[model samples]
Each structure stands twice: as structure tokens, then as C-alpha cells.
Target chain A: MSETNSPSPMRILYIEDNPLIAFHVEQMIEDLGHVFAGSLDSFAELQKQFASLEMDGALVDIDLADGATGPQAAAWLQERGIPAIFVTGQRQVAAEHGDVSLGTITKPVSSSELAAKLELFR
Target chain B: MNTIEDKSLPALDQVLILAPYRKDADYLGRLLAEHEINVRAGARIDDLARMLHPSPGVLVATHEALTPDALATVAAHLETQPSWAEMPIVVLLDRASRPDQVRAELGRVWPRARLLFYQRPVTAVELVSGVQSALLVRLRQRDVRDHIAQEVELRRELNHRVKNILASVTSIFEMTRRGATSIDAFADDFRGRLGALDKVHSAVFHSEGDTVSIAEIAELTFDPYRLSGMDRIVANGPPVTLSREAGTTLALCLHELTTNAIKYGALSHPDGRVQFAWNLSQDETPELAISWKESGGPDVEEPSRAGYGTRYVRSALAGMFGQKPVIAFEADGLRCEARGVFSRVAGNQ
Candidate 1:
């Protein structure tokens, strides 16, 4: 709530497969004053990165390459005490999260909204 | 200048105008005149319901005097509206009002609507911002719903087109085959080939537009003979998936083998039986083994002419195996053993 108590810059692992969105989100992460660990498309690659990389938070797309969605990835991160945000194309899916407090930004995500969401990771 | 629109707007169409007093509706009406939005003074409870159509776009219900009956009526109408409506109903409660009274006033309707509560007397900036937020959410929901509907319809259309194309191709092949040979002979050959292709297509379709399941391909290969009661076929393999190309090739090969069996092998007589089994081989060659053994037909002999079906079977097996299938027509019955490479093409976990 206070500026002096704000956490350090978050290290974000953004998992998205769409070429256009991935490109824009990667740029937006840097513009928002955070470190982009990397962007991954495959579940196998994501798992490997999670095991090896030290990330403070994650932004995942619900629908991913090879039928793996963001919810499963988010659950994994949450279990490890790392917060995650979902960037989804569909708002209906967004509404279905009745109680799940993890933030969601329905696509197409703007730079300001992305910054506002990622700020919570701190 | 003082009149409301005579006709109703289309269903799912919404208009929002905030009036500090009743006279402001007229000014707001002229401001939004070109947009053709419906504007009215003091909506009754029943008027709200009557105005609602199958599709809901937006509604702006602002409190006039917050009378007991009027407040209850708006509250009741809000409870009846659909959740997706994203209606912006502004309540003009005094900013310095008692908490208990405000709570009681809003409690009746707040539970239903995704509302933006604005304390009145309200300003233009606050009113416009509240209305804009609600309208933006409503428009977004509409776009997603429409896009999903279009996507589902397109998929169905593509599926229907695929079926039509396959059917026309079958007819063309039949017509060409008929012109080349005697009618009955051509019909029989064409039907057999078509049956093989249809089996593959059926397997593909049941797979939800992906590659055919190995389980499905096996059932298609043996289903007809199983019904006849002369031949009993058993299938066994790991959970394997096959591409459209591979499934069709296997279906055609199985048809050739089954036809030969029915004509001269175990299926030719009631006393005989044929067993068909396939499994991924252990050599790590990524290959599948389909072994067909015949038990009872009259003494078998290799035919003089390698017919069109035989050529197709040989070529298909050759392409799959890098060698011809082992075909032995012995004195007892005919035994065919084919090995084909396996590739998991779709619906893989």
C-alpha cells in the first residue's frame, strides 16, 4: 500500500504461444519496468524453465501450445507460492473464475493494464 | 422537441442519459438524436420489462425522487434483467444520506445487476464515466459471444463440406470403374474400395475431426465379419493414434485381405474362422504388426492374375513396410502378415 514498502521489481515468466501477442507482451514487460525471464510456448519448455529459472511471478495464457492451458500452469505456480495472472482471449472463461482471486486481463491486453496487473507481483 | 421516440429500439440495444432533473432528458435526447437511441422520462416497473427484448444491450435507470413505490419498482425490474445486460442504472441517493437508509434502498437491486453506484446529485464527468465503463463491458461481451458463435458455425460448415467432397469423389471413382469393365464386376470392385474408404472416413469422423484412433480403425476393419458370425476378430494394441493417410491405407489393406478370405479362405465357409490382431512391435522400429490367420476354406491357391486390389495391397504394404506383405495361400488356408510404421499424429497427450 505504501511506496517505501513496495517489493523489488518482479521477474516475470510470460508463457504465451501466439506470435503477435507474445511479441507485444514481451515489449510491454520491459516498458513496465520489470525483468522478462523469457517467453515460452511449449509446456515441456515451461516446466524446464520453471525448474531452472528463479521467477518472482508468472503471466500465463489459458490456452497454450499442445492443449495445455494457463489454469494448470497457474495452479502449479500457486502451489509454489508464486503469484500468476491469466491473459485470456475469452471473457466468458474470465467470468467463470468466481472466487479465484488471481488477476485476469482479457485480451487484447494494453500496456497500462499489463503494468497495473504486474504491479501486484511486488 | 418535447416528444419521445414513437417506436421501440431493437432488442439488445441500450441507451444511457443522466439527467439532474426531468428537463435534461430533452437536451440529452437532442444530443444523441443522430445515434437513434431511445430516451424516455421516468420508466415504470412494467415499462422496463416491456422494453426488454430477447437480446439486451443497455439500460440507464436513474432515480427521480426515490419514492418508496418507484424505488421498489426499479429494484424489482433490476432483479428481472439478465446478468449479461451490463445495464447502468444510476441511483440518485443524497451523498450525505444515512448509511442504513441507503443500504435498504440499494439492497433490493444491487444483488442482481453488475452496477456502478453513483451518489447524487451527480456531475457530468462522473455520469459519463460510469455509463462508458458499463457500455464498454457490454460491447466486449457481445463481441466474444458473436465470435464464438461464428467459429462453431464455421467448423460445422467445414465438416459438411468435407463429407460432400468425399461422397462426390466416391461417385466419380465408381463411374470411371463402371465404364472400364462389365457392370456387375465394376460395381463389386468399386463398392469394396468405397467401403474401405468409408470405413476410414467413419473412423476419422468419430475421432472429432482429428486423426483416427487405432481402436476405431480395428473395429472398422473387423465389424462386418463379426456380424456375419463366420469370422471372429480380436484387436489388441497400446493406445495408438493414426493419421488420415495411414488409416485409409490400413483400411484398404484390411479390405483386400478380408475379401480374399471370404472368397477362398476361412470366411468362405461356415466351419472356418479368421483372427486379426495388431500391436506395436518391440524392436523400437516404431512399427505395427497385423497378423491374419485363416482356418477353414477349400484348399487355397494363389490366383493367376494379381488383380487391382492385390496390386493396391502390395503397394500399400510396400510403402509402409519397405517390403511386400508376406502372403501365403497354403493348402489349409491363406495367411497374411503385414507390418506398417506407426506415427502418433493427433490427440496425443
Candidate 2:
């Protein structure tokens, strides 16, 4: 809550297939004192749309609507200077491709976890 | 380094022969070949490491081939064998060679190897049968290896699915809590949402192709009212299969709509009615459109503040359809309609 008063909110994009998860995390990003950059359901969407999306960072899920393309998407985002952290239940898979992500916040993400992890962007 | 994660295993069909004497190597290779066995008469010890890549099913070694260097190489291969592997080694010794001494020493040298000893005058039948038995053992090991791989894959998939379900439930819980006005309201809302999620999940699981049809979702969502002899709400639609994810989202939306109707919209009053209908377009890229209409209810009014049901339906429908839906609060009742590409959410069909 230290950042609540002087909330330097980050516009965080969520790349997840499940709308409910995306919505929940979107609200958490806002509650944790960050901005929601919006969401995309697949890596293909991110490829086509990243140029227009204004985001400081991203929370990516391992599985998306297309397939298990989250790691590749993270690497692509990294090349564009947009840092990403994995928001996944498959932490081992996320860890295997650790070079691309800042870190991972496991699913069923708590508000506290989102707050601390979002600070890494600053 | 091969573990349970190895996508493919080395073909263990060849019997590798280690014999320093050219005569012995040729004789053994020819004999094994005559028995319809694949034999690689590896003369030089230097090439043994490369040959081990596609690992041999059995190792046939003569007494003269047990040089310190040869033993060391074989020992190293044994050391690196995967947990399921136990390479069979048949050592042909001199007539006077004491079998116990050779077995004991080789046992210490290659602890993981299954060793068989034979005298120099052994018959072709004896040798072939022994090698065949060893090959059979190797085949069993490969089966074990495959089983382990399958188990590992199944466990990982199960873990991923369980985590996904937990994440989904947590999302529902948090969102429900946010919309909840009191503890009692929270419990009711949460339980209702969970029940809807569970029912849809069960339908998808029971159905072929991991899909749930639009009609099935409608039947499940409106079953409570229909059972109560409430003729106010009706679901009418052609058979349209939806992918599990799409089915789940739609089911939840229906739940929200159904609950709202029961509370304040249509089904709350005897005269009020709700029409839930869907259609598939006949275009090249077919689209699925669903509409919810409520009528004859108390004077319709847009809420001063949109609650969870309204917000969820709007956002979720937009996500599914790639277009915003029109949710109008007419003077008579509430109306919601959305249209989207059917291909985007179609099941196996």
C-alpha cells in the first residue's frame, strides 16, 4: 500500500485465454495501484497488436487460446523492450524459459503478490 | 543423460560384439547373423563409444576382449545407463575359465549389467537362445521406459488442469466477492456461480469431443425455473456445438442472466416472460447470435448503478464476440443481444 498515495500506475497488458482470469487480474492490477493496458487471448493477437498497445509490462499465461505459445510471446515482447512476467500455474514451464520473463506470479494471483511483482517494473 | 523426458529412445535391436582377435570377432558375428540376429562386430575399442549412441540390446564379449581399456569403456556405458536400463552382457570364457571369478569381478565392474557366462564350446543354439533371452529383457526395459514417459506426461497434464480449475475458481471468488453486498449475499452468489461452472463442466466432460452444445447449456441454466413449472423463461435454439472454453463463458453469462430474471426481471412475476434464443448465420464465415428478451414485467428501468451481472455479461460478451453487445433496458423489460463468428468458438464440428 506504500505506492497507493503516489501510485505510479503501470499499464499492464494481460495475455490470457480465460476471460474470467484476465478480468480478475485486470481488477487486481488496478487494485494494486497499476493501470490495465488491456488483454489479448493469444500470442498471434499480441504479434498483430503489440505495436498499438501501450504497456510498460505484461502478465502472460503459459496456455492461450491458440496454444502453449506464452514463452515465445514473452520473448517477442522482450525484443520490443516490453518486459513481461509469467502469470501461470505451470511454474516449471515458465521457469524453463526464464530468460524471457522478469519472473513468475503463479495463478490464483493474490493482490499482495500482484503488488510486489508489479513493483519490479519500476 | 536420457531421462523419462526423452522423446525417443535408442533402438536396442543390435547385439554388440567386443573381441580383440579378428578371427573371434568374425566367427561370433557370422554365428549371430546366421541366427537372424543383428550383430555389430566392433573390433577396435575406440569406436565403441560412438556405437553406444543407438545403444545395443546385448553385449557379447570374448575372454580376450576384457582388456582394461575395453572394460573401462563398458563400465562407463553402464554408469550412464538410464534407471530402467540393465544392459545384458554375455561373456564367453576359456574352457578352464572359472565362471564364478569372472562373474564376481565383472559384477563389481558393471553393477547395472545383467551378466551371463558361457564356456568356449557352447552351441549356436545355446548362444542364440541366451542372446534372445537378453534381447527379451531389453525389450521389457524399453516398455518400462515408455510407460514412465506416459505416466510423466499424464501427471503434468493433470497438474496443469487442476491448476487451471483452481485459478478459475479463485477468479470467480474474487469477482463475486467484489460484487457482494454482504456476507450472506456473497455466499449465495459464490455458490450459484460455482454451481453453474460445475454443471457446464460436467456437461462438457460427458459429451463427446469435449464440447457442450448451446441447447445443453440453456437446459442446464434454466432447469430450476422449468422444474418449478415456471413457463416464463424459454430457451430455443438449433444445435450449435461450442468449444469448452466458449461454452463455459456462455454458461456463466446465462447463469447471471437467469438469476437476474428470477430476482427482478421476467420470471419474478407470473405475467413476465424471458425469451432466450440463438441462430447461426448462413454466410461463408458463419456467425452465432444469441439474444435475451424479457417482457411484461414491472416497469423496466436501467439500474442507477450496473451490478456484477450487467458488467460481466457486457465484458464477457465483448470478449467472445469481438464486438460489443447492445443491452437495452426498454420500458417493458430488459433486452441483450450479441453476434460473433461461429468459427471462433465452434467445437469439433
Top candidate when judged by lDDT against the true structure: 2
lDDT of 1 at B274: 76
Residue ranges of candidate 1 with Cα displaced over 4 Å: A1-122, B1-181, B282-285, B319-324, B344-349
Error of 2 at B1 (Å): 26
Per-residue lDDT tens digits of candidate 2, residues B241-321?
Answer: 999888999999999998998889877888999999999999999999999999988888899988888878887887777
The sequence of per-residue lDDT tens digits that candidate 1 reaches over residues B150-221 is 676679768854644454354335333523468786677667767777778777777775577667777887
CA deviation > 4 Å runs, candidate 2: A1-12, A28-37, A50-122, B1-8, B27-39, B93-101, B104-108, B117-126, B206-210, B230-233, B236-239, B271-273, B279-284, B295-297
Model 2 alpha-carbon miss at residue A83, Å: 6.9
TM-score of chain A of each: 0.83, 0.94
Q: What's the true lDDT of residue B221 in model 2?
A: 90
Candidate 2 lDDT, A10-86, residue by residue in tens: 88999999888987887677667788887789999899777788999999999987899999999999999999999
Residue A23 alpha-carbon offset, candidate 2, angstroms: 1.3
Candidate 1: DockQ? 0.01
Model 2 per-residue lDDT at B312: 83
Judged by DockQ cut-offs, the docking class of candidate 1 is incorrect
Question: What's the TM-score of every candidate structure?
Answer: 0.42, 0.79
